[model samples]
Target: MSQAAADTMDNTHAAEHGGHHGEHHVLPYTVYFAVYGSLLVLTGITVLVSFAGLGKWSIPVAMAVAVVKASLVVGYFMHLKYDDRLNSLILVVTLLFILIFFAMTFSDMRTRGMIDPVEDNMVLRNEQAAEKAAAAEASGESSEKGEEAHHEGAAEH
Candidate 1:
């Protein structure tokens, strides 16, 4: 093999050579610049997002942007793009577990209104009490009615 071929082999070999081998692989300056540039751009985008009035959609947009930024860091800075299949499998499993957990949690939360009877009952009770209070006040029947009724009942008994 020519010197260029040998150099390329050495670079590729350094990745798989699992030992105290003196052979080292160095990243080019451009890679560093590219990673850092992406990071800066991500920061700028996050800042810009904070300034926008996206209403309820802002949270989803921010989360999507954050996931993209995390993927970039994992693929580039962590060198997962060049890593083995086992590493990717591990990452996929972790993400799957996270998804499952969040899915279950949200499902449970969505069904909470149906599962727990107290929330609707409490709201209905509050509305009924408010209506009754408003009706009583409108009819000029103040709290003294209860007292007067009790007094009249005691006198009759």
Candidate 2:
């Protein structure tokens, strides 16, 4: 084998194995600081929003901010931005499945009460109490007396 041919084979082998001798990308200190600053700002926003009395909207808003922060960290700090496209695609697909799972779980939880006989019974009890109050008012009777009589009847059992 010729010396030049051997050298060419070595180069080809190195290239095939993913040449680590190639130039690497290095992020500047400013970039790191910017990402850190952005994360801090998002944390502050999360705290502020918690105190803003958003009620039911707070959890979703905070989760959204957290997702943005996580993306920034993964893309820049974790070097996924400079990584192979396949890895990025895998991450996206994994996130999509996780989101779908959460959606399905939440849907199941939200609909559980609708199918529960205990919940239906509670609703029926509230309606019956309201009707009883209306009937008592029409008969010029106090609800307190009705409640007392009901309690006494219950105590006999």
Candidate 3:
């Protein structure tokens, strides 16, 4: 075939397939630099917060900073911001589910001690001792004498 005919055929094929025609979306260099700088600044903030002794707030603050950094990376670096709205919604829903899973796991872990069986460990033993001491105090008896008697009974056994 002639060169002109081949060019026409290629154009026709390109039009048939989505009309991409060798086109692409190129982001500016400054945008990438900005994202990099923001990530570095957020890393510094995370380190500073760790050393500042924020205690209970440290983890939450660090997580917030991380989420912001991740958003920037996903939006700009991953080009999700310019992508379809459905993709963004999918990302949001996935993140929401991850947050829910983490919350449930942490809740279960933190409450494990509270729901442990009475015969499980030393925690219940200490609680029982405290309760006995309180009962002795309410009955106008000396807790120290009660403890000594309990020890003597244990020794006899």
What lDDT tens digits, residue by residue, belong to model 2 across residues 1-157?
2553454455445544665356354555666777899999999999999999999999999999999999989976886665555678899999899999999999989866645375555555677888977888799887788889889989998
Taken over the whole model, the C-alpha lDDT of each candidate is: 0.72, 0.77, 0.77
TM-score of 1: 0.58
| Collision pairs in model 3 | none
How many clashes show up per model? Answer: 0, 0, 0
User: What digit string (tens of lDDT, one per residue) describes model 3 on residues 1-157?
Assistant: 2553454455445444655435443556766887899999999999988999998998999999999999999977886655555678899999899999999999989867865475566576677888977888899887788889889999999
Candidate 3, after superposition: displacement of residue 8 in Å?
Answer: 35
Which residue segments of model 3 deviate by more than 4 Å? Answer: 1-23, 119-157
Question: Candidates' TM-scores?
Answer: 0.58, 0.58, 0.57
The residue pairs in collision within model 1 are: none
At residue 25, give the lDDT of candidate 2: 43
Model 1 per-residue lDDT tens digits across residues 74-139: 866776654554788899999999999999999988766544265545455677877976787688
